[model samples]
Target: MIGSLFSRRRPPPMTLPDPAIVVPGITATYLRDDYPLPPEVIWRVLPFQKHFGSACLHPDDLRYEAREPALIRPGPLYEVAYKELIDELRYDLSPSPEAEVPVYPFAYDWRKPLDMIEADLDAFIDEVIERTVLTRHYYKDGYDCRRTVTLIGHSMGGLIIAGFLQATGGLRTRRRRTCPDHRVSKVISLASPFRGSFEAVVKMTTGTADLGLGASSSREREAARLTPALYHLLPSFDEGLEVPAPLPRTLFDPQVWQPSILRSIETFVARTSPITRTVRKRTEALFAGLLDQARTHRERLDAFRLDQAGLGPRDWLAVVGCGADTRTRLTIAALEDGPSFVLTSDDRRNTWPNGTDTGDGTVPFLGAEPSFLDRANLVCVTPDDYGYWELEDKALTRFGGGFHGILPNMNMLHRLIVRFVTGAPDPHQKTWGRPAPGVRPDAWDPPIPGLRNKAL
Candidate 1:
């Protein structure tokens, strides 16, 4: 009886999942200026309430071997945007609270290009694999050299993950290099815009790209022009454009950009940089540079064959949120004064759409779904994709337009991520798991185990 009581006290534990690395979206990392003695916190959460114009990068910053504008560098991940998800993963992922589950947070300069972030991520994955190898494992002998790690990328971070995986996989393209860490067995992307999101266009148009930090000013608009990250996120999906462009029908063509877009750069350059040439010439050059780089990045991704020799589309779990009125489509009217965007309401309701359940406020479903995968493979969740008990969490996570930012905090997402990473059986999901455009209700899954809840 005493032995039985002792056994009851220490219940058998579940297996710890693969070590995970969480990469947050844009504006989610703290950027600090270390040029000064004290190193001022320029782009953090609360401090960012007061607009910091100095955080604006020069066009030179886009160069491969360029330093910060003024010794500015990226710091830790923003708390409100990530802490809840991180804490949940760290604790719930472990067999017990006392047991440590390696959930590394990869914080990068959100202002930089996606390619740069992907390269850094390649290195980070290697380090994480090494670190996890050292951690004591009951099943393994000396060290698990081939120990794989699951990557959970939120928003643009998922784009970075997709780029990284493509770089490592069979099909190679530009910005593609060798990634030593082949142990990345699974990837979980939350609200990732694979094709692109119209919200990025809104950010470029209006300086206020609200990623939790409500720092909007003339300077913010100027900063957005140079932010290669935003350009990379410019929408290229079929359903993205309501009113098409004049000729190219692509945002990559600078002719499609609003005249104000170029004028903003002119004003920004005249104020900040040494204009060797005329303001108009310099503005056009910088504008074209941003779009050119983004075009290259997009082409590389588009060329990335997910159904490669070794890499399958199902290896990634893409959890896109819907049922939120999103700016799923935009009308770009060509005029004498160049193309003017008619996004959201013509009244400038800040370009937030009132469309159907097409997207998660920021990312359109037509764009977020993998280029290869269709309705049968894609897993679409919603803001209300949570249990009754998780309503508190759902409440805390403001749903509507900000669904893209707060998606990672959803309990249903957390549960699905854990299940996918740990190889845990999906225990009869009872939440909002809808099929895509052509997918039948009965044909969602269960037929293919790997392609079931285990995809991005």
Candidate 2:
């Protein structure tokens, strides 16, 4: 009886599932700012009451909310883009029948610079390790069951992960010592523009292209242009033929801007005849700021490329989309007389010297393949069609069926992702052939036509 009373029962061993962090692309986080009125403000006065609507006219009256990162959860677009993956992963990685997956959707201020975002990511990872895993594990046992994390990123998110891996020395190298606690077990990058995109340059020059996201406001557009991240997404000049030397104009020169901006400036100058001193000074100042930022961006990109040389594949899987018609600018030449710009193309036919190439719409096929990755680490999946047939029939295919935006929602692609993440059979083992038009086969629902060559 005394022995039975003294004996104590030990709890069951805790088995922690490996954590997978989902790093979303740009504009995945929502930002809000709060403004507070000063205590001296009187709302009841006659003048204040009469101009109540104009109260916001004063900059001092505005109190903007501090920038905070929060996940997009309740929007219609969010439901389609991110909700499915979050739900599926939660169900797949739940530690208990009632518990959710340890996977976290990391959101950040997309308007901020990439370097600032990188710091936030590092801190977030450390916090997750300590608070979510280590804290719980230490309370029960001394060591945590899961030590490493799997990073899954899409588009710019993939670039963020790449930057993080480089900063932390996560890639395996003979000379560099890897950090044990912050080690990455596996990395899945989808449609990442490691080599940058010409589309970004087009947007910067003309401000005409849409970034897949719905119509943006003037303020949002200005913010996007000002953000250094857009500069980082400049086209990889080395992808094809080099632009002729001693170029008369480039993106760096505001004088070479498209007709719209030039026309506005010309009209202003004409209206004011000998442009007023104050107006001239303001215009010159504006142009100076734009030129300085553009020059700074180019320098930063050059430095980033030099530092990113050591990023070799350790346990990386790069998924690239192909087949769909994609816009690609091969070369840019300035008009001899003035600063007008002309873009050349590098299509297969070469029939149209300035035609677009076949890719996943937003990201070119070549740009999706990072120069640092080995051939074996890459997998190119070409969907049967751009997945917009349904909307096309309804005359609602505004964005077209490009595979870039719909990658995460593709049924076949999702299966491939799950198989790879779970360590199942090689998802790329089968040789998938493109299905003929209007002929749906049962082999792999919406067949993923494998790429003919992986050299790109």
Candidate 3:
């Protein structure tokens, strides 16, 4: 009688539904592709001298040997967002058994070159094809050959996806592709710096930018200088974009750098200090190489002519963050001495041809958008509604307000993402190109919350 009274009730078993589409997610920078153990161990054993230890090791050598994680370790944002998506879709779509969405998270060393990242993504695509097409996973689940896989990318990951799409001819050439197995049906990008970021310029010049790394150590600063990927993040000045003219010249041509800064870099590069000189030489070489590469990469991207990439109306969607303070326009004046420099911004210059103010925290609202997307394919979300995701029938849905890092975890955003993946209609979503009603643009705030104090 006592045992019966204390008996616990068993919950119903979960019934997983057949996989309809395979969704793969790519993450942002500063994320550890492999577990942090080996590096952490090295850091622990190394002497903690200011700039004279293994801690000062650049990312290029360190990351190449780092092992890739079996699965992406979900962050706080991913945890909340993915959980909500799974719950909502399971209940809303009543398929045989519970709906099981096959989401494969791909990991890459964020410090590596873009071409290397693209190659990793390509390999991931091949792996997915092996699982779904070659193995009959799609056919077993009633998904026909016409069904295409979906890609979701955040931050720099979005750029990686774009490059992958271009290389694989997955954009407009999906239908014309000779290989049916590697087709991508749709792409969703969040806060991608397609045009570039002024923040990157700040980091390169000042050795400051909180790229999601925990603390700003001397080593972290040095690593930023050595990482080729950071240079790639600099502003791209193609036609139709209005950025500070001096900024691009400064980045591409070493001669344009302030004389003092250039001299300091040269001195550091030539230092005979046993510990720091090697690091400095590598950093200097990285700087020169990245400038040339940035120029070449920008030209290649411009040649792609994304606006004319031939994607269908529903093939692409870009979620833009707006109504927050973002660095849209920058003015750099060389100080009286060739070595000193001053940077300035005018909030009034927030629109195209003058400034860039509209954005989440890190990406300009305009920078988040691609030249090819008309009003229909863009969604603008503001800070007030930053975490909420409302679905719409049209291709774009904008949130009134939110920070860049917080977007992935918002419940509403998760729901909307689910709807897009499942091709659900949202009657309330706004028409393409039209801003949400009564949404006022907010004053300039730092892109990442709490970063104002840290990023100088």
TM-score of each: 0.83, 0.63, 0.66
Task: Report the C-alpha lDDT of model 1 over 301-333, residue by residue, as the tens digit.
Answer: 777765542445567777766666666667888
Rank all candidate structures by their TM-score, best first, as comma-separated numbers.
Answer: 1, 3, 2
Tens digit of per-residue lDDT, candidate 3, span 1-456: 422221222322223222222122222311322244442322210122122232222333433332223222212223322344445544554343433455555655555567677777777665564465333334444333333466777677677777666665653222422223435756667667766766666665565542332335444545455555666676664322333345454456554556544444444444422345466566456466767776666555545544343355465666666666676655445545543334545532334212335666567665565654554345555555532343331111222112565555445555555565555565654212223222322322212211111101
Candidate models: Cα lDDT each: 0.67, 0.48, 0.48
| RMSD in Å for model 2 | 10.9
Per residue, candidate 2 scores C-alpha lDDT tens digits across 1-456 of 421221222333544445677777654443322223322221111111111121111111112111212121211123345566766776755645644446778876554446567677777766665555334433253223333566788777787777666555443222212223344666778777776666665554544343434343343333334445665565554544235556433455555444444444333433433444565555444444545554554444334421343333545667766665565554555455444445434332211112224456677755665655533445655655234552243212333224565565555555555555554454465322232222223322221234223222
lDDT of 1 at 53: 67
Off by over 4 Å in 1: 1-16, 47-51, 63-69, 97-99, 138-143, 170-181, 209-216, 240-245, 307-309, 346-357, 387-401, 426-432, 446-456
Distance (Å) between predicted and true CA of 70, model 3?
A: 19
- Is 1 or 3 the stronger prediction by TM-score? 1
Backbone clash total, candidate 1? 6
Candidate 3 residue spans exceeding 4 A from truth: 1-99, 134-137, 142-147, 171-182, 213-215, 237-250, 259-285, 305-310, 336-341, 344-356, 387-402, 427-456
Best by lDDT: 1
